[model samples]
Target: MAASTAQNTTGATGRTTTNTTIRRDTRTLPAAALGPENPLPPLLPRNDPHRVSEEQRATLPAEMARQIGYAPLTTVLPTRIRDGYTRERVPTAVDVIVIENDRLRATVLPGYGGRVHSLLHKPTGRELLYTNPVLQPADFALNGAWFSGGIEWNIGATGHTTLSCAPVHAAVVPAPDGGPMLRLWEWERLRDTPFQVDLWLPEGSDFLHAGVRIRNPHETTVPVYWWSNTAVPETEGTRVLVPAEQTWHFGYQRGLRLIPTPRWEGTDHSFPLRGTYPADHFYEVPAAARKWIAALDETGTGLVQTSTGALRGRKLFVWGAGPGGRRWQRWLTEPGSAGYAEIQAGLARTQLEHVPLPAGAELSWVEAYGPLSADPAATHGPDWARARAEAEERLTEALPAAELDAAHAAWLPHADLAPTETLHAGSGWGALEVASGGHELPGTPFDPGTLGSEQRPWLELLDAGRFPEPAAGAVPGPSLVSPAWRDRLECAPGGPLTDYHLGVAQWHAGDRAQARRSWERSVAAAPSPWPLRCLAVADGCEGHLDAAAERAGRALDLALDAAAPAAPAAALAALAREAVPALLAAGRAAEAGRALDRLPAAIRAAGRFRLLESRVLLAQGRQDAARAVFEAGFEVADLREGDEALTETWAALTDDPLPEHYEFRMRPS
Candidate 1:
């Protein structure tokens, strides 16, 4: 088989037939280039200044990073195993079998990316689990191929949607001594497909591991979030335990509890699932964890669910200590009343093992999965310390040290749950909602957050300040914006980057003092390129153009160096140029000149600054000379581009006779 790719899910044909493995270019975006703007919006608002308002200063809950308790749970293999064959590093995608001394066997299938038309389950030996029906892929929303994106999808793909579950590997590991061993096949295929798993107790073993391996073909990497959509009839009873801070209360709203990240650091928060909820997609677990859900029941079903980590890093177990709701979740035939406990662990970074390497140069992540369970809640009894110990011990003894190290190394890329820096490689975030509409944001940024179902790209944007929200205008009163990257901030006592935009918002709303304060807090707390820009905006709006220019110049450098969007920085630069004379008149010519020259040549050419330059130059008695620069340089171009082609929202407000400016109306990149 020549190195290439093929998707069984029919859409359109004509894929490249070459066998050359496509490697992701490590070229950091010149602006950390992700996509060459494919089609960067030709026109953007010219409003860079954020005028503060009283509403901007509205106090909100401060969220912090460490509150959610995000730590990678590591399991090093037991050192007692023999050398060579038994202790050799277990490569991913290899099939191995475990033969028990007491007479039991388990098969391991790693990285087998295909459909299992014939369902197969073990242990219990009732092929019914896999034989009932060929659970074909669904075509509706609650789950469907409705929201999809790839360069081709953008070009001309019908429906433009589909859930992606890319498979990674499968490992058939034996249980400690002679217990219920497992055949763990980790795959990431979108819109979950069911399989037949066999559970063999082998007379003496008390535990087993259920594993599923998937295949991902989509260009974008998404967290494998398929729960047991089909509810097992609990004529006996069933329960799913999920960790959460406050059990999702209120109402079932959209068949799922939509939890907002406290602030945009990274969803690093978690608590026990409390109260009642009939969830379809209960988003109780924070972004910190995406796979590894647990299910158990009063009748003795202690099942631990989980997935493999992708680029986002870290796998999770979705349950904690709590019993706030009913004993079991509503069956699929009924409503899903409980939530799943899971974690978002990063995936292995090496692509040397993939069959047909994916396109694009960004880091991609897919989840690995398995189901660990127990039964008769009372059978184990109080503390159930013995049972817990047995399970833990089996899980520990299941692997040899070499294999664990190899797997651990593969997963190192996503080890840091709290990634404070942007990806030097490919990093993308798209809005997560599956919109029923067509092409929004046209030629601008890919906005997945506003669309509704947040993908990693959207989260990255919010964390990186690409969306620049009032994410859906906030909730008013106290809360504002959904918390995706909430726990990564300095929030609670105050968070990083929180006040920077708020200051700009208040500044834009004309709340100078609050803007100043927010700006101060923004810089002091995190000191990003934003704080300087916020300070500049505050100064310019307050008629302290001289100070504004100083702040603006510094901010631009930071934004440019970070490969961040330049619209805001550009707007600030243009505004500072206009404020030169105000500085000179205030006897600050030295600093004012420096600010003017500091503006990059490209931004100065945008034209908004010429208006102020006209005033500044004329005041310096170089009226003719000033007129020449304004007319030949700035004004003429402004006239050609027209007053409407500005990137900053407050551009018109700046002496540039442009028009009303607002960043929201501009397309997001």
Candidate 2:
């Protein structure tokens, strides 16, 4: 009976009969690690004077507590207060798992987020993916630590995913085709979900196969966002190809807007052209059957990413060649290193879109990353599409139906798998052991808004060292705020504007003393009203009414003197709003009235400034006028307003004792 079954079917092409083998090696290398001993620090100080008071927390709703991951007005919020990875590169050892066959070699860093550190095409000895020179971490992750380069598997919530910087269970398995494979598994604590990725380099194949599975372990439904971010060398002629006719553009502050792809006029946003401005757009890949995206350089040598399962979203995120782009490169990598662009694929149509996994449900798919040869000049829309189709055909041929199905079945019993054999440092070849852990890694405990807005013109201005002047008849940029601004300041410090921005970030982070110090430094460098106004706000928050009044008076004078076309009206409005409170606190009701009178009508009508007006009227012993101001402000923009700026203003005015909500801001924290 066994002999009869062994008989081959005519021209079935089910499995490979040829002798092929793959090698797996593991080594310990010096790298940074983040865990309980070294936890990430809070972005803001806990003792910040501006923090919501205990009295305020008591009045807030329970929902707000759940949203912020803590009770309202609590002094000690249940934040994920872990120290970040140390910058001092120590001799801390890390496990490096290498899997290779005749055609390709791939390295996996199991100790560092289980990322595919490098993928190389053996035939050409060319790296198929961008490899970071160092294993450095930045405060860009939703949990407050992110690293650039290579391929990062983002699962759970948005941003870089909670596990991007954490270690995952990894192991080596025997491929059905007789090649070696590496598998990584991570249990997401936040969502009570478990996920795994099985990677292999089949013999005689140029592509690396990644089998991904995400399972819901809970009884209730779970919402999830999964994306694979692959970085490649971006150059003047590097072009990204995704078969999409139109794209959705989502900016830092700018919401969703649609634009045609391949070309966007004057911009020529076609992947081959050199992008002058930063772009973070998502293109919908309606090609439900087979999805593919790639990035090719001028040399016609590049890499392609294709998925055999559902792929609703394709993304191209590039830090343009402009000053802002350059600064971000410096921030994410070591200096003098070339910046790279990202070609990403997701299960949803957009980054903000998520899917709900039913109880006991599981979703599985396969993705391929391979090298491509093409005519660089001809690798546009149709040309790239043809190349993708050919690549898919090749992959299908290499991974036949019988062999692929067997491999899928092996991965389904994730927990029953044996431990990966560990290879000691300098061992000829080995693999890292991976197994499911009892718990998920610690992630950010606070609400998403704690990270702040990514799109701040003030930050770009500080990085560019020049104000962003609008074109004739164009509206000026929006006002600058704290939030993620501190992360930017850390990258490039020393300038007057940078210091001023730093002060704002510090103030928001609850470090009034540091905020004052930064503002003082800014005043010394450029003597601008911006720094003085920020200083006044800090002083008032600290209960230094007299000092606040003096600073506010000087700030008001400087703002009036510096008022010009280039000056940001938003800054002027900020000064007026802050000065009135300081003057009122210092028992200078008349002075507060004068400051209120000088404010523009538009500023007075603004919700935040209206709160200031009410404060000014109250200090003048006119309680009725203050109430009227609050009533009118609420009538125009209620506490439930959708706009973040207005909602923050409402929180400040009502002293709602609840944390400000900015959940509307998209992920990638």
Candidate 3:
């Protein structure tokens, strides 16, 4: 790493400051220093017979092999290099760095997920961000264990990206405005992408500004997701304010649904108004030049998060005051761990929507988290925004005009310094669209009444049975399984979907016995519909018609019974395609007919589903009906001629047999 320092003098304020190299050092503290701990066993060495790879068996040290099933093989862990582990209170050390100005101070844990662990308001002696009292790990991350609190940068594929729990490279750089800045970054191996975030605390400022950059270093375009997650203490009157027109809900048993925010009667879902069931949902804030979200406590003091550049979405997740929430708190922290709510912002409109990062392209953005003054009487959406704006204006007026202009140019060049666009008072479900340009300043004549309808045209098209043709490429086949896929499966487990991928890898490797075992374990563990559908495909390939029908029926039943916030529209279509064929082959023609008839019209109209319908019709000795269905599908959209499983299954049904294997895209966890 290289070091750089600079000094600049401000003429207006007659103040001089020097930007020095970011200082990094190590500090030792008690292992339980952050919080209490009902420490679970070390996360490795679970007795899963299928987990022992040939490489591990061949290269294991004698000592490691002896404790393979009893203790964690710390040295072989993918992310962290653990010095040691203890069940009781023990001394632990981590790399720490600090960046501060006159009014605010931030502590960065470079070795522990590069988390901004502590943000303090020097004048008030208040910790503006929630600080976890203990450094405990829990099974919350995609790779099994993660620590809570602080602002975690989630990149790559969802659910706390791989780097969330791992150490990242850090450095101190002088901000363009001559302020102290801390930069931390890591290369994500799975996506072949590199991401970096610069944390800048300008002199005498209360806000901590973060600039993020993500680059796709691969030759091909890839799907990517980015979110900044911050945990804040939740008090009785804690409220979350998001400047969005509508909200979308997705979770276990909750099918995809849209609703109005803040004004939901009986229960104000906008904030922690009343504690009932656990509420975990994502809200899509239409793209606006001035994007902001905040969480305030009873005393009116809280954190306000604003972003510029490519980030466009915001999410609020609260573990309610129920038993499940309590259990989750225990799992994530020690005995005295306070209940906290997460305020998250993302790069896309919704988590389910994948944003494409073109090859060799980069995305850049800035997000600022600052202290918000309390307004005890401000409870509604408009009131909260008003109070926040006033506080922001006070800070702006206190800074030198030149420095303010330079700072605005540095992070928000495209956005004008203005109050957010006016929001409509009326409520209704509508298509959540991204805003076209930057937020308009207040007092500028603008219409708040007719922003737009809530109905989404793209969603309406999907509902109308029109799907865009698949991208031009051979649908990835099982035969194309590579070493990278195997490594990913090995590194990430504990999810039914990951298990399904493992089964797919095993099947492709010519190991049916292990494949079946893996699939069975997957369903036993989570019962998500994906693995069941895969098992049905395997049974069909083996000519076990009766067993195939049974599995396929179960898959359909589970999917249909799910209270999915949004229909797993694509997944359901795939399931219908597989189940119809199996049901027909098992001599259950009536059941097969019912299965096809029950599919949503929009789904049944899809090219893939129509193909499956045609196959079922042909199997029932109705060639004319099958031909009509096939032609109708083509009329809807020109079918992309790929999908090895569909092609092979159609061939086998037509007495034109091909090699047998299951194929599906891996879903992000």
Candidate 4:
């Protein structure tokens, strides 16, 4: 952690300022590698029930209607599930980009989705964010594999960004107010857009400024989502303040209700520890109010996040004081670690909505993060209005709203400045997109030279109008579901691989019937398991459970037979996961058991398979065996956010209350 520090008197405005240094460093932590992704494609669409009621929808403004759940993802195709991480932890060195001034230090992890891993205030030597002790990947992001802590830029969909564990291009650029700025940019695949984040620390400022811009290069309107999620250490005395008397409460029960902001259910909901279950409190900030949110402790000193007017919404997410909430805290990191809550800012009122970016248009906003301190008694007082006023007064004093607006205007010109140095490289998809569409993104260049193996096939298809086939027994490559690529794929020479990818692209476009026909043609050309499993999904979606089971079983058998002896276990596990559930749905419990047994012993030992095994055992009337599976204590690495299967299965097996370790229920029943 040692590094050299020096003073450089240079400013973006040509005025001399205090000392500031921008350098690279490494941190050693107990980390687990994000292993290979699931080979099986996600055929089913994201079916999270995140819709608002008719009455609530009617009350929303016209712009809200355009954004609410627009262009829902049919599938997370191009991005695969990253469920390969395990509980085993080993010390590893992680690269970090540090930008520090005389008053503060901001450590950025460009390799980890450009996460602001730590923000330290120099005067107090206090960390402003909840910096995680270990790097543990969990199934939290939109495409799985997310770590908890620091500040994360959530984009693309409602959930965490697909690039949570992926790398992003980083470089040094000129800061608006002075010194060097750290810029991170990447191509967001779900919306087919490119976005950039510039981090600037003025010479002597406590606040870390982030300039964000998302551009839709296509001719058609695109639904865009952006949220800056900051994790702060939570304690019983911590209180969150937003300038709103009412808030939207959304629990895991798939319902959203407007309730009083601070006091709800005769308890102070502003305190993260007051609730009994995990929940989201989206503050209903007034249109005229300055948009900001702060998490202050009893002593009235903590992190505050504020943005320009365009970034309108603010929220607080807490894994509450309940047993399940406490258990989740331990599951994400190491045991006995301090709990944390998320204070977030977003474009829409709720994460369930997306804002529409018009054709060939872009949206830009500036967010400032720093430490806030106010009178302890007033901030933690019984009077909610006084507490909020104290926070607002302190925030304005630290960083004025007008100052933030001026900063945005000043940074606009520098946003397009070319990078002086490239620190890290992200995915080649952005370059591939530029290669195909010929986009002219100036500052955030997706250099064609960065294209690698993953983009080679798509590049070939773009150049030759044919998707190249992989070697025998090799898992299918990544998918491209954009309209232009789909059109090229449609005209490509018909083959097993080409037809299979075309079916996926068609499915993403919502043409189910055509997708089915394409998959059938793919199977007819070459009877491979990939297309067969896809057909299984189609059957299940169509409510042909028996046919789905049969297809899944056939697909599983083919995959096992064709797999090499040393093939990655994930390849087999992917098919087995789909087949087992389908078999159970078709009431073929015995067949499910046989299918589960076919997997290697180690794969079956994983948490997901063990849960499936419990279901299979219960179906066979072996209640004791099912209970044993739960008692063995397996962790579902890819357990979805709102999935209640764990608790539901526990209830079905016995009358006993669900075990604390398995209690991830976010809703109060």
Top candidate when judged by lDDT against the true structure: 4
Structural similarity to truth (TM-score) of each candidate: 0.26, 0.54, 0.53, 0.97
lDDT of each: 0.29, 0.57, 0.56, 0.88
The candidate with the higher lDDT, 1 or 3, is: 3
- Which segments of model 1 are wrong by more than 4 Å? 1-139, 142-236, 242-246, 249-277, 280-291, 297-303, 307-368, 371-375, 378-405, 408-669
Residue-by-residue lDDT tens digits, candidate 3, 1-669: 212333353322344554433455555644532222111111122221112443543454343233233321221112221211222335677667766666776777876667888888778888877787667654345443467788988875545655654666555444645444566665554354556677776655678878777766556776667889898887777888776656765433323456677545456776652645455456656554346677877676788777764677888877666544554565455577677888888876544444678877777777777777744565434553565455445334443334533564574432211212111111111111112112222211223232333223222222342212222211211111224444445555244544555676666555667768878987897675666766777787788899999999888767766763433554565567567878987988778878878888977765556667777777777877865663343321211111133444454455443212121111111
Per residue, candidate 4 scores C-alpha lDDT tens digits across 1-669 of 534333464546786546676777899989988888887777775546456666676666666655664776767777887878887889999989898887889998888899999999989999999999999998788787899999999989888999999999988887875567889999999899899999988655689999999999999999899999999999999999999999988887766778997998899999999999899998899999999999999899999999999999999999998888887788888977889999999998888888789999999999999999999899899999999999999999999999999999989998999987788899999999999999999899998889999899999999998999887667788888888999999999998899999998998888989999999998998898888999999999999999999999999888877746434688788889899999999999999999999888999999999999999999999999999998888988778776789989999999998888788877786
RMSD to the true structure for each prediction, in A, is 23.3, 19.5, 22.9, 1.9
lDDT per residue, candidate 2, 1-669, as tens digits? Answer: 011011111111245423233233444433445533111112232221112344543443443222222312211111232233444445544556676665777877775567888998887899988887766665555444567889988876545665666666655544445334566765554454667777765546677888887776555777777889999988777777666767766555334556877667656565632665556667856654457777887666688887755555788887666544564566555667877998998877566555778877778877778887765445643454564455445445545434544555644443234434432211100010011112221111111121222233443444464434333322222223323335556566476656765665565566778878988987897676667766776677678899989898888767666634434455556456567767877999899888777766865666556666766676677777765665553322111111234334334455544222222222222
Model 4 misplacement above 4 A = 1-17, 47-49, 53-66, 563-567
Q: Best TM-score goes to which candidate?
A: 4
lDDT of 4 at 222: 91
Candidates sorted by lDDT, descending order? 4, 2, 3, 1
Pick by lDDT: 2 or 3, better one: 2
Q: What residue pairs clash in candidate 4, if any at all?
A: 12-178
Q: Is candidate 1 or candidate 4 better by lDDT?
A: 4
